[model samples]
Target: MIMPNEQKAPLVHLANAIGTMSEVSSRVGQYVLANPEKVVHQTVAELAEYTHSGQASVLRLCRQLGFKGFSEFKLALMAELAASERSTATDSDNEADRYGALLKRLTQSMQKTAYALHAEQLLAIAVHMVKARRISVFGSGISGLVSQLVSYRLMRLGLPAQAFQDPVLAHEVMTDVDKHCVALGISESGVTLDTVEFLKRARTAGAKTIAITGRVNSPVAQAADLVLLAVPIEPLTIGGDISPAISKIYLVELLAMAIADLSHAGRQRNERSKTP
Candidate 1:
């Protein structure tokens, strides 16, 4: 924990910033915010595992909030709890506050993603997605996890979508790419070598390529026929830190919604023609 703060600063900073932390960091932050007293009694591993985040996330959260490490964070927390009055806030109340903060953060991120990526652009790409014979999404690490989510969302919309975490497997699949196919890649930095290469090859194979990334100048974007700006976000969930991935997830949901709308409108047009 590198960001330095005073004794009473622990809870204060955490309550304010939990809304913006990475998923891992946010999990830890929310828990601590809800139960600073419980955390002061637990070890680093205990809290990390309990929150389903790693010890590193706990330590990172501590450092970012101005503690040297979990030890110092605990000390500060203890001091804050000691200085604070005994609260009547129920367990349910704390849970609600923690969840409310997280929801607010997610809502803000979704709003940012929408404003950053134009509706016209999203609809244009969505048109191709709806008409594509098939769709392949590539990603690695946490990005790979996001790819699975994207695939699942599109699949739920009745689109043929698949996610590839392994570059080699993605390569084999790319061999099947054709003009009717759509290839999408997710990489926050837009420079992830494997994801960029996959999109490049898919484009070479004649598929419409899309990239969700943070930079327009990135190799992945350069290889893509269309680029969906993955809003630069921080403070966890759907981020590569869980926050980075959150932006990507938000984009995918928007794309899915667009596809659903387009499909509905198209069906309505067909119905009207038949009725006449």
Candidate 2:
């Protein structure tokens, strides 16, 4: 039988340098290994509750496993799902096989795009959000939806953020953003006329500007203080623009979670300072 001290050793070790993992970290790792299938769909909070560990512990375990965090880990698992084609493979060798194959290919492509995201870049954006006095987000088309989501998440974390999808509003916001504020522009092509103009204006106004786009070499990226590049995966057909939209939304969610983590850490620090 394992003693209490023995049981605590793994957890303690994980708590200490959970930044590195080599086949083992804590009970969390053991649990994930045992239930690999479940890890694909589980959230950090769900995984923590499942393993009887804290949410932070789960995040630390993911970091130890060489992931930027839990979101990247989930993306990796989703890629595995795409590779296996668990949802598409069936015994129906009928005439509709062409459509089935196309659907499977599209899903796989989108999953690959998501898996290709750079976690470090998202984390860097989160760090900028934590320090910026104000944030203006801009995008057009589906990317506009992503910008709105990012702004909403940042606001919940107590950051001053606004999503300006309308060209007029974007220009107006850019003109008035404080010099110390940060402007984040989102676009898949990175060449959206309005987005590029707003980013340029924000930079000219002395605000730190960031561009989240699939095209790192585009004009919007060229004018920003920082650029977070998402992997580009446009649709193969005219009516299939949903894949890139979903990928962009996923990227926004990951950035939001990272910012939330930083915000919580800051709150802790402020509370500690108030303790006399």
Candidate 3:
């Protein structure tokens, strides 16, 4: 029952969640990761036995990775294996192989992040933008670029939006953000102290807060009223320490598009009302 879903990567996603998975689940994940080629051709019961865990544990692991069940997980695994095998056929030059691997990593991370985000949440964030008096976007380092990117998109829609890269200045502005403002914090780690502080202070001032971060349980998410999860995959870059999650850009683009549609609809309605 291999489904060979080209749009999703089960192995990539499972690896990402392995860090925070339970002991039993981690064991199951490690087994599949270590022997993906073997596991792809095995039955559910066999995999469970191989991992020294039960069938339920195997099934549970599948669900946690956002698959319907074992069959779906197997399908995705088979597809990933097939794709990897195709890539391997072109390993003539070592440098090409390395470049291909990094390219695949970046693509897979973006795909997983796009797959993980929910449309309802994106729409909800858009709804907030449509109703807010002003928008404040916060991020540091690479996330700062994402913040500014999204802020510009919002401005293009004629929404009152501003990007705040400086935490000190952001903090000063947060004081003026009443319940009418929507404060968005973009962080790859979600634990950036300055960004988290901005969200906390924004909430304290009765502003609507939203966090777009890779960590679901991070301080920024905990402080904000809404959380949008993205992949923390970063490029091997020369910038400072690590670059911001590339997934952040994808999510913000999705947000901007959603907000645009909502903003357009709202404007049309307003014009219609005035015409009467």
Candidate 2 at 74: error in angstroms?
Answer: 31
**TM-score of model 1 (CA atoms):** 0.61
- C-alpha positional error of residue 223 in candidate 2 after TM-score superposition, expressed in Å: 2.1
lDDT of 3 at 6: 29
Q: Residue 66's C-alpha lDDT in candidate 1?
A: 77
Best by the lDDT measure: 3
Off by over 4 Å in 2: 1-120, 234-240
Residue-wise lDDT of candidate 3 within 1-276, one digit each (tens)?
A: 224352277777776677567768866775565456678788989988777789999999988887888888888888877776666556425887877766675676576566556577789989998889989999998788889888988898888999999999999998798998899998876789999999999999999999988766567777889877765543223556443356677787888889878877878999999995
lDDT of 1 by residue, 1-276 (tens): 325535465766665565466757855664564345568899999997767778888888887787778888788788766554332122126777666655555565555455445567799899999999999999998788999999999999999999999899999999988999999998876789999889889999999999988654467777898888664542323533565677788888888889999999999999999995
User: Which of the predicted structures, 2 or 3, would earn the higher lDDT when compared with the native?
Assistant: 3
Question: What's the TM-score of each model vs. the native?
Answer: 0.61, 0.59, 0.68
* CA lDDT of each prediction against the hidden true structure: 0.76, 0.66, 0.78
Clashing pairs in 3: 3-75
- Superposing every Cα of model 1 onto the true structure, what RMSD results? 12.6
